[model samples]
Structure formats: C-alpha cells, structure tokens
Target: MRDKETRLKRRMEPALTPWSGTTEATDWSLPEDLLQQASRRLSILCVVAAVLWGIGLFIGNSFPPRFAGLNGHPYPWPGNLVGGLAITAAVAMWLYIRLGHARPATLDVGLAFLVVNAFAIGLLDEWAPREVRNRSVSWIAVVILTCAMIAPSTPRKTLFAALVAASMDPIGALIAHLRGVAVPAAAETFIQYWPNYAAAFLAVVPSQVLQRLGRQISRVRDAGSYQLVQRLGGGGMGEVWRAEHRLLARPAAVKIVRPEVLGAASESDVRLITQRFMREAQATAVLGSPHTINVYDFGVTKEGAFYYVMELLVGRDLVSLVRVFCPLPANRAVYLLRQACHSLAEAHSRNLVHRDIKPANIYVCRMGLDYDFIKVLDFGLVKFGDRASTRQNLMTADHVTSGTPAYMAPEIILGNVETDPRADVYALGCVAYWMLTGQLVFQAETPMKMFVEHLHGTPVPPSQRTELPIPRDLEAVVMRCLEKDPQKRPDAAELFQMSCQCKASVPWDHEAAREWWALHLSEFTRGLTLAMPAAPAVSSSPVTR
Candidate 1:
C-alpha cells in the first residue's frame, strides 16, 4: 500500500511541475477558423461579382453602341478587360481560400482587385466629356467603397488599397494623355478625387484598428513574473489564465482585467475599476483560512492592466461537479459546505462580506492527501463595512448589484446598505440546495425574476425538489440559512457547527476522494512536463496584503 501511494504521488507530481523563466509575448495571427471564414466570404462575393459582370458583357455584345446606350462611345476593349479580370481574380481567390493561404494572399488579392477596377474606370473616364470627369470620379469612388466593404482585408490592407486606388486615376489619366488620349492633367485628377480618398479611409480605419488591437491583446502571453500557458475562462470584466511563476517555478493562475476595458472607459470609471482590483487583491491576500485560495503575487502590468496571481488548483469547482455528477449525496454536500463556511467565517471576522458566493466561485481541489478540499475564490466583490471609510462606502454605495442573481440573498436584491455575513449565509443555502437537488431554490427565466424570487418568494425544501433522500437534520440546516430576514439566517460560524452536527453517511471524505480521482481524474493529475533547462533560485519577494 505504501509503494502504491508513492507511485501515485510520482505520477501526479508532473501536474505540479512549473515552467521556468518568463519570455516576452510573441506575434501570432487570429485563429485559423476566423481567417478562413473571412476569406471564404470574400471569395464568394468575388464569384458573384464575376457572374454579374459576365451578364452585363453579354447584353452589351447583343446590341450596337448607339442602341446599347454607351453615350455613343462604346469601348468593348475596356469593358471586356475589366470583366475578364474580375473572373480571373475570382478564380485566384477561390484557390486562395481552398489552399488556406490567408495572410499574403489576402493583401495580394485586395491590391489586384483595387488596381484592376481603378484602371478600368480610368479608361472609361477618357470617353466622358471634361465637365463629367469629376462626376465620373464620384462613381469610381463609390466602387472602391463597395469593394472594401466586401473584402476580408485588415485596416492596414484597407488603408493600402485605399491609397493605391486613390492614386490610380491620376496616374492612369497622365499615361492616357501621354498616349494621345484626351484626359485631365494628373494634378487636376488627384484634386478632384481627394475627397473620395479621405472618405474611404474614414469609413473603415477606426473600426479595423480597434478590432485588430483587441485580437492582439487577447493573444498576449507575457505579463510580468507569470507566463500565460492557456486561457482558463473569461467574463465581461476580466479573464483568467493558467500560468506559472518565473523564478519560484510554481504553478499559478493569473486573472487580468482586459486592458481595453479600462482604456475605453471614462477616467472616473477607470479609477473605480483600478481601486476595486487593488482592494480585492489586498482583501484576499489577508484572508487566513486554509479553505481560501492562497494569493502568491499581485501587481499592475507594464501595459497598465491590473492582475493577480493565485495558486493553481487541479480539481473542478462546485459548479462543474454539480453539473456533471449532481444530486450529490447528502453527507458530501455537508462536507463541502462546511469547508466553505470555514472560509467565509474567516472573511466575515475580518469585516469583509464576499458578495459573490455561488457554486462556480467555490472550487473543490485535491490538496495533497486531502480530497474534497474547498477553496473559496473571487474576493473581487468583497464589500467593506461602514467603519472602513466614507470613500470606501461611496465606491460600492451606488448599490451596484454585485452577485450571481440565482444565488443572491434578499437583502442584496432589496438594495439594503447594511448587507453583512447573513447575505453570504443565504447564498450558501442556495449552493447547498443546488448540490443536493441539481436545481436552484427558485427557478426563473430571467435574472430579474430570479432576483424578485429572492426578495419575496419562499424557498422549497431540497427533499421536496428532488428524489434524493436528504437527511432531516441537513434539510433543517439548509432551510435555516434560506430564511429571508438577516436576523434569522445563521452566521457562517453557526452554520459550520450545524453542518458538522448533521448525522449523515459521508461518502466524499479523503479516502473516497483519492479513490474517485484515481478512477476518474488520473489523466488530469498526470500533467505535461514543462521544460526548464536552468531553474532559477527562488526569490524572497513579499506577497501583497
């Protein structure tokens, strides 16, 4: 048995192995799917344009110049050339899309499309009277705008195409005049088309630049001491990544507020978010519960994005566990909730109320020989008490609703200013119900309805909601936590004791957790070994508090 456990630990140790020394962010393109989708859409548009041009050519050939209404200056050479070029360009685009060559080919095809169209329009402009030359430039400008709208080109490509297309008429007119054709002077042609050129650039540049910047930021790997390995998840405010520390060689998870979120916000809003981020990091770092996530490091990046590092966990959160194997056994639910209570009890004693306590924020990790170890996460929404400061109170005083609606307590939903540890107690009750019943205490379609139910509706007992036999003692404890009034709901310390008192057959203790993980999560434990040629000496940098 001793040898077996030793071999098990060896296999799992690779999962804890950290990647050494940080590297700078490398340039990478958008994913293949996005590039291919944009390319295919542009190629299809080219095919449609080619077919339309062929039909127009057939109609022109079936009649005389005067009867065809070509302004009595029918030039089949220019029309045939432009139409044939469109068809050839379509074929090239089709090949580009089929072969999946997106980068260089996209620019090449865009340039060809712009130059050929401009040259064709310039040739036809030679047939128009001098007074109509400026009018013809307007029509040609419209063509360029329409093509840009259909192409899958980036801002850089669009800008290049716009500049090349803008210059073509002036250059084409000069060449035509040199060949003895009656055309406007190069300077005059450019002056007339300048407005159109400016308009084309204005229409596409801003949106494209914003899009390109957003994509580039999302793919960034290096952010200070931690190097991002893979994106874990993201929300409206920020994103979380599985990362590793450089010198310490410790596996960690990093959460970062998207840089653009602050860059695009008003100054006051930016200040609020930054303050909130720092407060959260400090608050979480001060928490001393073994059930709370260990904060490793925290700081602002060089690019002005706020980020913090936490110990990376191997097991899934309660949300995932309930989703995959719910209708959890009664004792198992009690075991997990008791650990969560211990975390919240510590936070409450420190005058911090964790506004968000949903199942998703409560992770069940395999900590060494201990299985079913709960680690409460995301203290970013921790609300300080009135004793802190008027400024601190004003920050969250707007009564910004700050928790999952499904798990929110009545006081939070009612916008009460004095929300306390009781609010967390209510949320914990909702989590317990979800674990034992696989459904929320109250089911509603919209978030508003869920909030309304929390504010006014009574919660159904877990035993009545599901077929699973929830023990009477545990059921009583869950019901007590779900009480609407803050005065009635039990505090975390009391709930922790009550959960311990519940006499139910526990099936998710340390032994069961190890056995279950050996059967179901062995692969997750045996992680890939990240190469670290020369592991650096661990630094003694102090953690933020």
Candidate 2:
C-alpha cells in the first residue's frame, strides 16, 4: 500500500524538462519595472534640458555677449534656431512620456532621445560665436555622463549609444564648415572634442559596473540546483522567490533567510534562529502527507544565505480567498479545513506541533484533476516534544511573540512551555472562523490587545459575524477547537473526524469544486500548462510583531 501511494505521488508531481544552461543568459534581461524607472528618469532629464535651453535663450537675448567678439553679429540666427529646435524636441519627448505612450519600446525611445539631446548640444556649440565656441568643457560631455548614470542597459548597448552621441561633435563641425562657417584647424578641433569623446568612452564604466553587480546578485540568488526568478513577497524573516530547477526546468518557490537578518542578534539568538530554520526544512521534508507543502531541497549559499526549495502553488491562500470572495460557504470551508486537518494530523502523530496555523498558512490550490486542494505551509514554528518551551523563550527573547497574535492559542499567550497539538487545533479553529466570517476571532487595536482578547475574551460565533449560513455541526466543531482550555479542545485526529461528520446543506465534492473554480478562476485555469519531464520525476507570510 505504501509503495502504491509513493507511485501515485510521483505521478502527481510537476513535470520537468531536460537540463540546459541556455536559460541562464536570459536572467540578465532587465525587468519591466526597472525599465519603467529608467524611462521616467529619461523623461525628467528631457524636461530639465528643455528648461535649461529656454533659460539660455532668455539670457542670450537679454544680455550682451560675454566673449571677445565684435559687438555686431547678425542676431546669431543659427544659434537661436538650433536652440529653439532643441527645446521643441525635448518638450516633445517629455510629452511623449507624460501622455502614457512610453511602453513596449520605452528603452529604445529613451536611447534615441538621449542621442538627439547630445547631438543638439553639439550643434548649439557649433552655432555659438567663434570666440565662445569650444572655450569651456562641452555640454555634450555632461549629457553623455548623465545618460549613462540614469539609464541602465547592456554594456554593448551603452558603448554604442555613447560613441554615436560623442561623434556628433565632429559631425556638427563638419556641418558648420559646409554651411560657410570658417571652422578651427584640425589640431584645435581635436583638442576641443577630446573631452567629449573621453567622457563618452568612460561612460561605459558605470554600465559595466552595474552589469557585474547584477551578475553577482544573480549568483547569490542561485541555490544548489535552482535559480531564483523573482521575488513573490517578503517579511521580517526573509523573502520568498519564484524559482525554477536549473536543469529539470521544474517551477518551484525558494524561501531565503539571509545572514544579515541576524546581524544584530546575540550569539545565542543567532543559533536559535539557525536551528529553527533547519528544523522547519527537516520537519517538512519528512512528512508523508500529500496535503503538506513538499520540500525538494535545502541548503546554504556560498554567501551564508539559507534557502529551501518547495513545490510552487498556483492558487491563493485562504486569506486571499476570503478577502476576494468574502466568507466561504460552510461546505467549502469544511472541505479546505478537512485537508488542513489531515496535514496537521500527520505532523501531530509524529510528535510535532505546528505552532502557527493561521489562514495565511493554509493554501488552496489545483492538483491535477483535483480542485480546492489544500496544502499546509510555514512550519517554521513547529514544536518538537519537550523542547517547545526553550524554543519559545528564545523566539520571544527580543519581545516579539512566536505565533501570530490573531490566531494565537491561550496556552501560547500564557507562556506555557509544553504546548501540545491542541495549540495548533485552536489556531485551526481560528482559521475556520476567518473562512466562515472573513473576520478575525477577536478584533483588537494592537497585537498585545489581541493577545489579551484571546486569553480572556469570548469569541463571537462565526455564524453571528457573517450573513453566510454556517452549519450548526461545523460551528460546534470550530467552537470546540477554540475552547480556551487545552483539555476541552479536540486533538487534530478527533477534529478531523468531527469535521467529516458535519453535513452541509450542499456537501462540497469534486464536481462542485471544479464548477466553482471554472466560474471564478477561469483565467488561471486556462493558463495552466504543465511542463513534461525528459527524465525521471524527483519528489519535492505572516507578520512577526
């Protein structure tokens, strides 16, 4: 029977593709958010350039020429025309971004605008009176340096853009000579243009530095056999990343705990945090229940960052489910809670107590032909027999509590050292309350106040808080689990049996789950694409106050 179950589990796992190193190069591509930021910066630069040009035009007309030249120089019509055109172009580019047309090709458009700005500066220089032209550092240098600083791109792309922009100085000089303007000697022109060209050449340094830094960060994100894709979310402890197996191409989620989070902690606290992390990975990996989140691998990176890879879930947690859809029907709540109970039951039978069991920790996802499948997650606070108190003390030493205050059991609040499986049972009951009413069991202004309510206040029944009709039997089971006294609460196994007995008006079944998902999650359902493996299948938030 065990072997048959293992075979079934393997078949249910996500498919993986053959290993390839080709995808690693794709990681260097700038994300859309970063590109958007670059576009905004470029737009701002254009506006600043336009304003500077307007100011220059105002000063030129209002004051006498501040250079050694004849007082009479035919209104400098060429300079005025070039300056006006530069201002117009800068304003147009700014408007282009402000009007919300800066996407799909934002980087390309920004680069083109940057090159135009550089060329305009060079033209303005060439059109200035001969006495003033090439007398000081070129404005083209400033533009090149600023563009390099603001916009990030590939080193090759940056080099090409900078070189093209720099060449505009010589090109402008050529245009001047062709237009009957007597240009300076070649040696003097080179002396004047050298700074602009040098600036352009040096601009690539920042791009190279940024790219090298990005590569280093990518390396740090790389775990044993998986590569971190993007961050899903983060909390006080660490971040969770969407990752994929490097070789097999199987999608997964990686949770990372960097060493810096413990930098301010004392040695003992650091040791406790490390032990807790290891315990979380070790405990979850050994659990045989399919309802529990599967751990595929865990290790420390070369930089001392700890990470663990687990199967990626494609659906929302109960918290989001309630937030989006409001209170769940009693039947559906029971369906999800039963699956969570199964996971808890397995952990409890093995002398493990999941100290944190809130709605956020209970995920409901699609599993092959099955819908509304629940997977229990976040076992970082799991308590083994006899060591529960010591671990709790270390966790609370910094004045921060262990389990979430909203779903914390009375025993945990009272600082009981030997909390049993009933603690998780109480927390699960709180989760049921949330699913039924879309509200916490107790409403308090602060975490401490919430803790006080859990300790001394009576919880309003779930049925009273919401318009949704919760079944009497299920309500009784939830209230039984919420009993302040541990002895009055049913254990995980008993709670599972009790949950199974509750008969809803319309019992949740496979067909009902499928129908519900199709109605509400059609987009996600339609987008699901399972990757096929070329090789044998390998078995795999919460606020801290």
Candidate 3:
C-alpha cells in the first residue's frame, strides 16, 4: 500500500506542483469569482465615464460664447471628435463585458481601456485653452483611483499600471510642443502634472490593503487541522473546498454549510436542517466498508458554518464516465454494480437507506493500485429506517421532496412516509438500466411527469434497448429489483448474491480495468488525480423531487 501510494504521488507531481500554496503560486492563480467582480465594476465605470463625456461635449458645443472666457479659446473640432470616438469605444467595451461572453479576458481588456482612456484625457487637456489647462481637476487621477479600488491585484502590478497612465500627461505636453502649440515651461510643467503622479503612487495603498485582507480571510479558512486550499464548487446550501492536513500533508475535501443558509430559515427549520446535517456526518463516519466514502473529521467554524473533511478520491463519477465513454459492456457493468452493492449492503445492515442513488452520486475512482474502485458519496439525504416516519415528517415539513426525479422509486413518489431499503434497490435497478443502455428508464419533460412515469410506466428490458448482449440471469436480477411492490424487490444482500451468480463471456478484473483506463482516460486521470471535486463530492446536482 505504501509503495502504491508513493507511485501515485509521483505520477501526480507535475499537475499538483502549481497549486502547492507557495507565494509564486498565489501570484499566478486568479479565482473566477475575482475575475467576474472586476469585470462588472469596470463595465459600470465605463458607462458612467462615457455618459459624463457626452454631456460635457453637448454643453460646451451648444453654448460656446458663454464658456469662451472659461477656456480662453474655442473648443477644437479634433478634440470634439476624439471625445466622440472615446465614448463610442467605451460603450462598445461595456457591452462586451456586461454580456459576459469574454469573461476570462475581461481584466486584460479593461486594463487596456484604462490606459487608452488616460491618453485620450491627456489629449483633451492639451486642447483645453490656456486658462483651464492646469487649473482643472485631474480626471485621470479619478480614473486611476477607481480602477485600483475595483480590481484586486498585487501592489506591484497596480503600481506599474498607474505609472504608465500617469506618464501620459507629460507625454501629451511634449507632443503639444512638437506641434508648435504654446506649452508650459519646465517648472510650470512639473506643477501641472504632479497631482496625477501623486495619485498614481497613492493608488498602491488600496491595493496593498485589499491584498492583506484577502490573506487574512485565507488564514481564517482553517477547519480544525485542515486548511482549505481552493473552492472546488458550491450549491445553495454550502461549498466544498480542496484542503490539506496541516501536519500530515494529506490531501482531503471539505464540505461547509455556512450560517447564512441556516439564518434564512425559521428557528425550527434551522434545528431540523442542522440535525439532518449532523446525522449525515455521523452515519457516513461509522460505516466500515471500503466502498463508502471515508470521513476524517467534522466540526463547526467560528462563524457557525458546519464542515466535514473526507478522503479525496481521484476519478470521474458514473455520470461523466458514461457520458465520456459509451455504455459499459455486460461484464464491466456487472463488475461495477457488485461493488456498489457492497456499499449499500453495509448501509442497509445498519438500517440506513441512501435516498439519493443516482449516477452522479456514485464515483468510480483509482484507489492506490486499484482501478475501478467504487466510492458511494453524498449521504445528505440518507434516511434512518428505524425512525423513518418521524424523520420523514421533519424532512418534508418544508414541502421539499428528496432524491433525483429520474431515479425515484414508486413508493417515494406516492409519499409513502415509511420508505425502506427497497427504495434504494429500485434506484439501483435504474442505475443498472442506465449503465447497460446509456439512458434513463423513463423520459419525461418535468419532475411531475417523471413521477407519473415511475408510478405507472413499465420499463423496457436492457437487452431490448442495446445491441450488446446481456446475460439472461443478470437481466432477471435487475428486473426483480425494479419491481413496483417493495415486497417483490430483492434486498441489497440478495441482489449482490444474484449478481455474483450471473455469467458473462468475459470477466472484468484488475488488469482489464487498468488497460481500459490507460487507453481511454489517461489524460483525465492525471489532470484530476488531486482534484475529484465533481458532483456530490463538491457541487451537487439539483434534486428534482
């Protein structure tokens, strides 16, 4: 086991090194949330600036005689044309950013506009008649300060951009002299441009302040001995983060339920949600099966967010597995299903029913030297059969039904408060049908239509839907599990026994699994070796019913 782990680490070193939490790594990485925030701020500023420019041009051109004393000369036609073009450009850029199609390049595009706008302002200042040239407020200064405030960046980067923008005023003065326009003397020039340069230097203060605050928040992301590295994904209830053990250097995934999600509910609803979350953690932690996800620790943050740390697995969930590749062969489907049965068997023995048993919640991972290892995840909707009636009442008080619509059993849709382990058996049969045919048992337009189908529709056999041959015995076992009556469906233990007896032309074993992965999914495995944050492990799919 130690040797296998070492080999796995060595294989993942190239991809993991960039995210190892060093200063250089931090400088290079920019989260998507930050990018979108910067884009939105820049878009708003551009629109405001454009509107003000248009207003100034309209007023000055309309009442030239009244303003003639203010500038000591007529506003030049070239200056007016430059202002018009600038406004048009700004509006175009605003539309691009606001539409959100070019989000990844938004910061780069915004910075380019900032530099160009500063130069345009300098040209307008040069054209301003002598009286107003040096006395007017530095519009360039306002632009620099606003951009610095909105975009979070390293102080060094902010300083560099500021300096570039500030130099435009001096550069503009030189251009005026070359064009034979009367320009200010050297000492007077310094007085005119000093404010812009000063503003440039001061902009770094906000940049440094924001960077420090970001670091402080990162420090506060610790949950017991684990430190969150990056956000993997989030849902309505909470977020999941990629984390590592402080002392052990082991990689893990942490799921957090923030206080605000609970704060929005009434006090009684808060109690019920908190109780359900705690039960999920407790139930998952006690299970001994290797097929079940292993919980390492659970706690609440100082801010009242509930969190649980679990082992990070490396592979795609069943949904991605089928979507990327094709439907599994008869032998391979049986091999994977038997492992899932192992996990369900253990949970059922403890009177636990996994209410959500869709393909997205079942993962196929590479564990140590073993490929195709199954890890059942997301027990958030797990039902305790011993207290089924009372827990069901509490869970459904909000008029929300748990479990995915496509995989829900007939009894669950009918509002049977005492749903048993057989509901999971029915869902597992849906999974088998999906694996063999690459489709759901019933198709419908909405959750209600899906519920109706599960209640009244008869499923087509896997063999009839696919060209690949399925053994008669295996097909019988799947059909038995999909029976509408709870009494007719086999228990998890019996399901496993029946699967083991089914014969296929070829058996799926370790060597076959390894060869298949290397041929079809080698790149995916390497990229996700330290980041299995998909679906229920990080972000969960929305439950329909």
Candidate 1 residue-wise lDDT, 311-376, digit = tens: 877677777778877678897898899999999999888778888888878887677667788889
Model 3, 434: alpha-carbon shift in Å? 0.8
TM-score of 3: 0.61
Question: Each model's TM-score?
Answer: 0.63, 0.61, 0.61
- For each candidate, the alpha-carbon lDDT, in order, equals 0.68, 0.74, 0.74
RMSD values for the candidates in order, in angstroms, are: 14.8, 14.6, 14.7
* Worst-scoring 10-residue span by lDDT in model 1: 536-545
Quote the lDDT for 527 in model 3: 40
Question: What are the runs in model 1 whose C-alpha is more than 4 Å off?
Answer: 1-171, 174-222, 262-265, 390-399, 525-545
lDDT of 2 by residue, 1-545 (tens): 45644653353232111112122223234434555677788788888989998888877666655543643232356557867888988888888878876553555566677788787777766754475454778788888888888864666667788888887877777777777777887678877788888987888887777666654454445466777666667755767766777678578877876555544335555555655666677678888899999988776543344567788776778877899888899999999889999999999988788898987788887877789999898888887756754554343354456888999999988877777789999999999999999999999999989999999999989889999898899999999999999999999999999999999888999899989989987644554465522111211121111
Q: Name the lDDT value of residue 266 in candidate 2.
A: 53
On residues 269-344, what C-alpha lDDT tens digit does candidate 3 reach at each position?
5556655555566678778899999888775443334677888766777887888787999899999999999999
Clash count, predicted structure 3: 0
How would the candidate models be sorted by lDDT, starting from the highest?
Answer: 2, 3, 1
